[model samples]
Target: MRADIDGLPVRELTGLEYASIVEGVSVDGEQSPIMHACGHDVHISALLGATRLLAEHRERWSGTFLALFQPAEERAGGARKMVDDGLDVRIPAPDVAFSQHVMATPAGNVHACLGPSFSTADSIKVTVFGRGGHGSMPHTTVDPAVLASMIVLRLQTVVSRETRPGEFAVVTVGKMTVGSKVNIISDRAELQLNVRTSTSTPGPAC
Candidate 1:
């Protein structure tokens, strides 16, 4: 498998020491920036395991098998790049391609679905625009902090009260940052949201 242009940091998975070099001070704590909470390491490990299994059973299968350990899945365009890089032509195009994910579900139970099983996930960023003014004057500014709060709460309604019951929909404002400190009415605010789906309720079609 080819490597990513900017490969994922292995130190994110296995880091021995925290450095205090020229870059910046490294804080020591149980919580570290390099974490496998998203499970990318698990994915790579499983790919290796699958490769070993396929190698061991090489005699059983007759047709050619193309094993790809692709990258940039978080960006949602890695598979397309591999295809554009002649993945299907140089390697004999297989009749079907497959990928598997392990999620927080009922223990000891495995399940699979067909026809657009997972929903397309994407990130949404919203920047609330406002006017800045002195903290003493209450009505002088647009108060983007309040507007950002309204946006977050209103987005939730799009999923719960708006979307169809069977159709799965989610709009979440995961992070919000406004004023740096007290006594300052910030002029702008930013929010980041992560959205997800299943075959029972597919997102808008491309």
Candidate 2:
């Protein structure tokens, strides 16, 4: 069994009855609030409890019970890091494996399904280049901010028009950085995009 133990770099809502009070410095050396918004805390706790129970009743079962506590799952590099760190040689490979995630379901309810239950996700960063110049000189500069905006608008059509009906696909431009000031046009603009597609869906959804 495996459970992710990473927390998201997001601030909790104010005026909540059980908001996180702890503050920590992030990997970038900046102070930020941390919260388990993805329910990885619940996953870790559940895995610990289950491991304890199985340990106390080891006589009832026969086999190795490896409980994997993963990290950096929010960035999606935890599993790969573990493998690179010699996880394969340290632990025995099992015939079967199980992992769980907390979903938006009612309490005391557990869901299980065969085949692919989760969607495939990808993160992409795109940078468009242009010519840096003063905002007053419209003819002298190529504006990458405008190009980035055009790309964002065109990406919306990938899901709405290119994707077939009933197919599950999402294309989101989460972050865009352009010029620093209104009077100046930057030479380059950066875009952070996230794409998600259902595993069961056929063809390229995005």
Candidate 3:
């Protein structure tokens, strides 16, 4: 069992009152707003429910259960950190590992996929360099925000123009960090991208 505790640094969009109340999350001393855009909260709740049920009704089950609580799925390092902390030596290795994800579906419906249910994902960070200057002066400064915007637009064509017609690919600029103040132009812009490569085939219908 695994749960990702980290949230994306995105503003809350839901008007519901049960939305995330956390103000900001700090990463490497820099603080930024965050929200649970991913379905990690559902995964964590499911894991907790399963654990409680198994514990409360031990007689209904027989085998040992190992609950692995993990964090930093956004950084993609939680499992690796656990392994590095000697997870193998801490307990007996299970016969198999199981992972479940929550997805939107019809009520009371459960769906599963054979082979790779999700595409291969990759994360990339790119910093667009520029020359910072006062906002009052336009021509003097090379705005990285402008550069970032152009790069992001160009990245959109990577899948459409480069990939084969039958194949599938994606490029997304998931996160971008630019100038802090409206009156100042930043010297650099940080960009985080999540790219997925499709792994589907034209299979026979049922």
- Backbone clash pairs for candidate 3 read none
Model 2, 1-206: lDDT tens digits are 88888877788887688777668998758798898767876887899999999999999999778888999986789999999999999998777765566788898998887876778889899999999999999689999999999999999899889788877888999889898998999999999998998844466545
Q: How does residue 70 of candidate 2 score in lDDT?
A: 91
Error of 3 at 43 (Å): 0.4
* Candidate 3 weakest ten by summed lDDT: 197-206
Better of 1 and 3 by lDDT: 3
- Residue 143 lDDT in candidate 3: 96
For each candidate in the order shown, give its overall lDDT on alpha carbons.
0.67, 0.86, 0.82
Model 1 whole-model lDDT (C-alpha atoms):
0.67
Error of 3 at 65 (Å): 0.5
Number of clashes in every candidate structure? Answer: 1, 0, 0
Ranking the candidates on lDDT from highest down gives: 2, 3, 1
TM-score for model 3? 0.80
Q: Give the Cα error of residue 60 in candidate 2, in Å.
A: 4.4
